[model samples]
Target chain A: MKRSSISSFSNPAVIAELAAHLHRNNVASIHIEAADGELKLVAPVGASLQTTHRATPVLISASQPGSLLAKAPTAGIFAAAHPLRPEREISTGSAVAKGDIVAFVKVGPVLVPVIAEKAGKVVSVTSETGTLVGYGTSLFTAKT
Target chain B: MIHVLGCGPLNTIQDLGRAGYRNIGVTATGAMDPIALKVGNLLVGNDEDAAGIEIQTFPFRIEFEQAQVFALTGADCAARLDGQDLPPWWCIRAEPGQVLELSTPMKSARAYLCLQGGIDVPLVMGSRSTSLRGSFGGHEGRPLAVGDILPVMAGTTISPPVNGFGIVPPAQAMPNLFPVSDTGDLILRAIPAGEHDLFGDDSERFWSQTWKITSQSDRTGYRLSGAPLQLSAPVELRSYGIIPGIVQVPPGGEPIIQMSDANTAGGYPKMAGVIDGDLWRLGQARIGSKISFRQSSLTEALAVERAIDAYIDDIRRTLPLVANALVAMTKR
Candidate 1:
């Protein structure tokens, strides 16, 4: 559902400021859903994002056949790869084994690995690196 | 419990080290790279000063006799668990009977293997570190040998996600502070010691020339081979109390930098004392590695110490937050 009325009033600078605050504090992402509209801001993961925050309402759809959505196990900053091993980052089209560490959710100084639920090819990475994410946030869409 | 299936000589159990006993003629024998041990312990939910296995000689191999959590830090020894490659500075859980092996490292010289709750060695003189010189602490007062079964203390368990996680090594995380020389020599910061003036013009050579760590080096001290640092004249000085990091010049004129297992007293002339903050880098320096000294002031030394303290403080403050958060998250 498109809320054109509320979308017209969202200020770009306000969103940028919020995103900057999240990055400065090492937070992953924030989501606010109200009766009028929804505002979601995520920090960049691997590389710096050209656009700091995403304010547009996301489209929610049913899972397609053979597709599996890997959700975040807890809330924290999402990392595409371990901080020390960036070259092994999991990306779209990367083949992953069941129980493989496709990414990480960093809480403070500790990094909690984000595991692959099943062996599959990553169809898409829904979460951006360095962005704040909440528990159960869909991080990757993969095809088994 | 873990059984040492294979190990090299000199690999020993060490903690932060024994303090206040150097007066009684006991060397503060401990991990050469103490920072690595502390970080490894912190990663495994152990106290910063917890005892761990400091593995220098390799290929060291061990088998987990029981399920346990462990963290590997310091030198990247290309460790593997049941043939699965693990990154350096990583923490993970191992199932019973899982074999963990470490190969000779290509870069850094020592690797610390810290288990959850630390190694259950009897604390001798207020620490669990082995006093190899005195042969009184750690596992039977000697280095770890094959078939040595070390008991790990019971610790509060926290769940880590499958495949585990790792942190950026301090060398990479805190770069550009005390940088390496452009010529690829390890740069060590030092404060002029008592006998520094005696070297006269030779003191300049000590600072300018890159010294190679000779084969005679060990935990006690690194005998550097470079231009002879002859003093203005021969002067006999009485033997006095000494500690690690003191740069002493003996009759041979080559400088010797004291280390973890340094003798309690020495009679040689002192040139410069390496700053404590940079000692870990020196600890990991391999034999044949080139190193040069950069003169530093007390203010600069304190500043560097503060930066290292901040790094450790960050880990101490944030580890509990992460553990608690993970426990709550897993419960859901």
Candidate 2:
């Protein structure tokens, strides 16, 4: 099998053309190697190959290096503190331990706590109070 | 199962109180604040009227014998579990042998503790409330004491981890709908009762003057001290059915407002009855707290009841969805 190299096709238009060809040929998945990077595309179930990229699926491991992003455990309105109490809002740079309630997601009258899964120092809070957040969306970032 | 390590003032098991037995002279004998009890039970996925602990004193403590879910409602007693503070009205799970302690309430007088199913107690006269007078129901018909062991209703099915959710307590000492006096006394809405007109000039003073809850008050009745309220003339009457919130005046001229554990029937002249909607406010009223009464139309009284019902309806509709969502999230 001849290896396909996409180093010469630095323009995005060329990549789009190649993706269109793969779609026409009914290819489900394909990997292209470039001079500085690689692109991998897998067609979604019951669909043809795409021309644009979807969200990059991230695999989070506790041992992963650098800053760790804390994501929403569920979908709801994010609350930096207790809903009835605005003064208890969690601030940036606070120390958090495993299973500590750092924030909440309010659904109706119920507040689901966004607990820390590992001990770390909070670096930033990305979600605003009362803002809607989807599951796995980055809510905050912390350094272990 | 749970063990009572210490009880500060008074702790009694209460539900919505017994009904129908009043015809035979049985007091309802339930929670001083039924709204608190109902909200606490609903938070733990229990029936709204399920039995729970009504803590009247402060610094109460209990230890869970097994891991279970529970909720605290009513007064903000500043509760802590295993040394970590819990927000009032939040439902949290307890690990085995974890101690839950309650300090003096900051806002209201009573606090309720509701378990997932409820506090397991045999119903007496259709309720699990403790009848202090009758002494026949609720943990041997008396207040919970130290070293007492209470059984919790067994969980029917494993529920989702409902660890963080809470609602605002419905009991407000000062609600905006009613008038509040300059002295910060709560103004409870009232309607004319059977002998309302018999009080003559006293009726006018009842609505105008602020009354202080005397130290003699308890679950049975609140002895109010203010301007003396006397009847137009001495009248003899047979004992009649009396419910909670009925304002009765004895010869001493001091008006007494009936409570949850009030006598089923009384011979005192009933001057006015507090509206059902404002009864919860009375329940949260502490000794020395002052209150004034407002003459409200029956229509207005009905409106207050409707608002309370609607608030409860909102909770009933939303709590189940919250519970389900929690379960689904945990499964993931």
Candidate 3:
């Protein structure tokens, strides 16, 4: 396949710039392709295609649970449960608050904690600390 | 029996792959490209998810202890059995002591080799896929090795190869296996998520404008390099549910997009997600490529779903014919 580069943002500093540009340009069809292992977005037409889009969440089980959730907003080292140093134990049905420091990450000098939401039995502790993580990646499971 | 002569960096038994285990913390560890697996199986009259061999980027040799019909697919490797060329996506009868070979990846990472009758490997969680990180399923949950004796069941009774080779995956249905872009940066269309306002306009601009992918990408997520992932509401928000391709920004300013094996929950501020269709691209991204993100409306994003469904519908159309042929063969 032919190789190419695509830059969606003009400023390349914040996504808002792209969002603003998208709103202004009204991007219709965004063509994101990978050339040479890189992903590029190529959509000359802006915003007009909204008419062809769909609306709905790919929900499973229930619409959602009423219980609060604890999560990692970004990627980093997960500290609680993991393959090597997994979180083997947690208090059963304990009421934990959000940002309760249930786990910690060592990204540079920042040691962020994997927190807890209003807790129940620690349903599960997913990955381990120092394991490469991603944004919106989870670390704990508290069934409320 | 199909015997392994020499395994490369990684090679393992894979079937349709493990599913429904994400909620229980297990990845759907299976062949990276399901379509290729199907092509190989179709040629050999094996179940698409049947136990077979997955060849990694590197190449190796395997010896069949008995003559068996088999096919290889994915990566377009130059395969040879006893110095004779082997056709991809086509079934062939190999004689015992024949040294089957896979030379190199033509345009992809993994490839599949399926015997006429599927190999009857024990299943784990209803699959025979290998989990590299966890190292627990599919042929001992690890790559293959030399001198390993693999069991192969009798080829299922099926129509002649004439009817099989007549089938071809539409060109569009073929996976990109290896992406053709070098921009390392992953462009994902996303919906504004929690903390959308917290980062305010200025930071969002940075997210959209200046960023490249870090060398730190894998099956989990891609890390962005640029201004610190700052938020307008800098206050820490409680964590919540996260999905593959979900873009989350931390205090450092880099936005990471989750992948197929991403965790189910998180604590960082989510700005948006890499659109679902583009997600598979995440699987092929090489490290240190440039990356960018765009906001997509719910309606626009669903367009991706519809597009994908059309592709699936095409595959579904062919299955009935194959299944019918199998039924007739069994009756005979």
Better of 1 and 3 by lDDT: 1
Q: lDDT tens digits, residues A1-144, model 2?
A: 123543333232343455456556767555554554344433333343233334333322234333654666554567787644557676677888777777876555556677777788887787687565544456667888
Better of 1 and 2 by DockQ: 1
User: Share of real interface contacts recovered by each model?
Assistant: 0.40, 0.27, 0.00
Candidate 2 — which residues are off by over 4 angstroms?
A: A1-98, A114-144, B157-162, B171-184
lDDT per residue, candidate 1, B1-332, as tens digits? Answer: 99999999999999988988889888887889888988898888888899999999999999999989999999989899998878788888999999999999988899999999889989998999888888989999999999999999998555444577666677765886767987878999999999999899999999999999999999999999988989998889998889889999999999999999999988999999999999999889999999999999899999989988888877776665556544433432
The superposed Cα distance between candidate 3 and the true structure at residue A12, in angstroms, equals 51
RMSD of 2: 11.3
Q: Best by TM-score, which number?
A: 1
Worst 10 residues of 3 chain B by lDDT: B161-170
Candidate with best DockQ? 1
Cα deviation at B299, candidate 2, in Å, is: 2.2
Better of 2 and 3 by DockQ: 2
Q: What are the lDDT scores of the predictions, listed in order?
A: 0.81, 0.76, 0.56
Better of 2 and 3 by lDDT: 2
Docking class of 3: incorrect
For model 2, residues B229-249, the per-residue Cα lDDT tens digits are 888988998989999999999
Ranking by TM-score: 1, 2, 3
